[model samples]
Target: MKKVSCIFIVDDDPITVFGIKKMLKSVASCDDIQIFQNGHEAHEAIKERLKEGKIIPEVVFLDINMPIMDGWEFLDELIALDIKEHITINMITSSIDPLDYKKWNGFKNRCPYTLNFKNKPIFKIEANDLGCMDIAS
Candidate 1:
């Protein structure tokens, strides 16, 4: 397992973000952790970082349901950017709709960076299962 340099949590749910952050802190060694309320904000920030030649997040936890922009929309925007960085995206959503899964599979096919499609409320065990280790060590 490799320690992630940076991580992004793109979800409108504060509780979900908090839980994920706490779990990440406990299980993974990440240098930077960024939180965005929606996909739109995350997308914009990523573009800005790219423009400024700054390091983008290596991993992203995205939620499918959001006010401004949904996870799928975010993935579309990200693919459009064609960023060269090796980013791994995990789809974390509460949606039980089968369509969501289908869409996620389609996105995974289109975007090689996508890693896992997980249900909401991520826990420390899930993080460990994802193989998050301190690569810096």
Candidate 2:
């Protein structure tokens, strides 16, 4: 699999975070994995990295409903930042609301980089598939 420099898991659910982390370990070669409990924290961290001219995480697993700031809010804030790098945001969620899919479709079109949608507890195969996410870039 292609190596990744960094990854971020933005979710408030501990169990989901744990599961995703473990799955990622088995499927990818990323060495840096940062976990954020809320979108507010994640956004702030990203800002700090950008200020330092550091590479923003190449991949982010974002959940829709989180305290302090939801996934949509985080995405909005992130896209507004002056980032020059490519980011792959995987919308991992348990919400089955049809509205979420509609929202995702709209968001996907609006996103500047790769944006994918998936259910909670991402599978190993899907995680492994991320190796090719940067191919076109």
Candidate 3:
């Protein structure tokens, strides 16, 4: 039951962010949750934190399509920064487009740290969804 110090959720949709934050509280006690409307703003915030030598989020949920900068572009910027290691990032977009899935899968293959693709309402904080992994005391 380790608490996540910070959780960064980057999506253009406000409602989606609200739902995800609400669900997260049930799993781990997050000290702070930063919600950004677009990839650019999210990326900027991350960089700012890094500059201040602050602890980054334990998890980041990114959306695919967005204004100013999309998820793909943010990934490129991230790599260009020679990001050796960072928190686990999961694509949480609702896009069912084949191309989007293909890109996501490829990235997963390249960077296994980039975890599973979870559609909306499938936040990783569910206990029942833990299935066999849920050990019985």
Predicted structure with the largest lDDT when compared to the true one: 2
The runs of at least 3 residues in candidate 3 whose Cα sits more than 4 Å from the true structure, single-residue gaps closed, are 123-137
Which of the numbered candidates is closest to the native, going by highest TM-score?
A: 2
Q: State which candidate, 2 or 3, has the greater lDDT.
A: 2
**Tens digits of lDDT, candidate 3, 3-76:** 66777888988888887877877776777889988889988887888789887666777887899999888777
- Per-residue lDDT of model 2, residues 26-84, tens digit only: 66788888999999999999999888987789889899999999999998998888477
* Per-residue alpha-carbon lDDT of candidate 1 for residues 1-137, written as tens digits (9 for 90 to 100): 34678888999989998888877776668778899999999999999999999898888988889988998899999999999877878888888899999988888788957468888555553543333434423
Instruction: Determine the C-alpha RMSD for candidate 3 after optimal superposition of all C-alphas.
Output: 3.7
C-alpha positional error of residue 10 in candidate 3 after TM-score superposition, expressed in Å: 0.4
| Better structure of 1 and 3 per TM-score | 1
Predicted structure 3, TM vs. truth: 0.82
Q: Local error of candidate 1 at 57, Å? A: 0.7
Q: How many residue pairs clash in each candidate?
A: 1, 0, 0
Worst 10 residues of 2 by lDDT: 127-136
lDDT of 1 at 16: 92
